[model samples]
Target: MTLLLTPVSLADRVEVITPGGNASLTPPAASTEPSDAAVETFPRTTAATGSGGTTYSPAEMDTQPGLQTMHFGAASLACKVASSTTDLVVINQSPEPLPAGTRIKWQLKKEGTRGFFAIIGELGGGESLVADDVLDGQAGKDDICIARVI
Candidate 1:
């Protein structure tokens, strides 16, 4: 099967689970102030004002066939599937490296399960992660993919 690398904005779907709870990771609109739910989720993230302002904010990530890429703050997680095995490609884009063992998970929701089940998945440790197997034949047409970085 062929998969197109279409960029989709996962504004409300992406989340980061922290010790406090699951916090929404969607970056706020530039024109408007960030809502309370749009707060930073990673603890090691830079909170100080920099040349560009607050350095940490969740941003939407993209995915393609056999691979999905997601981000939170300065961390990036890429989920790839090949030969029936899924592997997570983690890269720390931030200056400070993310601590090892940060929980990262990628899950493809089962088709027609109303978001209650996952058909295929893999786990890894990182600073951020996302899951959306667009051409994996396991996700529904209108499925909402959730990438969780704990």
Candidate 2:
């Protein structure tokens, strides 16, 4: 016995064939564009003005210590600190939901003014992390460690 097969193309549908006969066609569902809220950007200050007539410009600030990019499951994250303080900030830019129990770890360097310090904190219900004294001193190059629990 001999078998022969013929291929057919439909305008916008997909078809399959079994030995019995041609299978029913079902077009794929259309995809929707992601919402603007799904996308997020890191927050950065061009310059900071504090009490005692102190001003720190981004250009003048030293390079952030242990700067690294991280992904928490489906969410994207970036970590950085000011040149002057122990305060560290992490930004989440993932489209999927990020619950309050996620955790992230990264090496940090405390430089500039405040001595190198290690920071560990947790993310709150509103998708923000709370810290005690993460970014607290002169801005320079110091290695630090930062971990966030989301």
Candidate 3:
């Protein structure tokens, strides 16, 4: 009898929305193979107003930017042989705080070597924000998974 092994992989991306009405999307740029594996990291920034109606700099916001809504992009990863479980981790490396009710979307696709598979998931913490909130005070992280499918 031959024993089979299942493989797991992960990728990450970030979409940042600034208080000045500007938005940006960062896509995943790394891959993991049967022999070699790679992980990608993304950085983001946002501006916010203080209690006295003062605007804070990106660095200042790092301490406590208040809760903000962020848009995330779908990550693409491939496995040579399908596995029983797969996980995707999203890390918040921004200078602002992300409150609950924050949502993320994932999409799944499967195609050929050049073929592809993808999944999207959303998260909400159910929290609120008040004035004088720290720009980066509430940094948070979340994860999504794909399982039991070839």
Q: Each model's TM-score, in the order given?
A: 0.24, 0.30, 0.18
Better of 1 and 2 by lDDT: 2
Q: Compared with the true structure, what per-residue lDDT tens digits does model 2 show for residues 1-150? A: 999988985674435667888643443344584332333445564455555544444455435445554455555555556443555555554455455444455445444232232224443333544333655444444454444423
For candidate 3, lDDT tens digit of each residue in 65-111? 24353343332221222121232233333333343434332222231
Backbone steric clashes in candidate 2, count? 28
Error at 19, model 2, angstroms: 64
Index of the highest-TM-score prediction: 2
lDDT of 1: 0.41
* Clash pairs (backbone) in predicted model 1: none
Give the lDDT of residue 72 in candidate 1: 45
> For model 1, how does the per-residue alpha-carbon lDDT over 1-150 read when each residue is reduced to its tens digit?
998898886665545678978644566666664455545556556566646654665666543223343344654434333222222223333444444444444444543221211323333334333323334444433343333344
lDDT of each: 0.41, 0.47, 0.30
Sorted on lDDT, best first, the list reads 2, 1, 3
lDDT for 134 (candidate 3): 15
As a whole number from 0 to 100, the lDDT of residue 68 in candidate 2 is 53
lDDT of 3 at 65: 28
lDDT of 1 at 136: 46
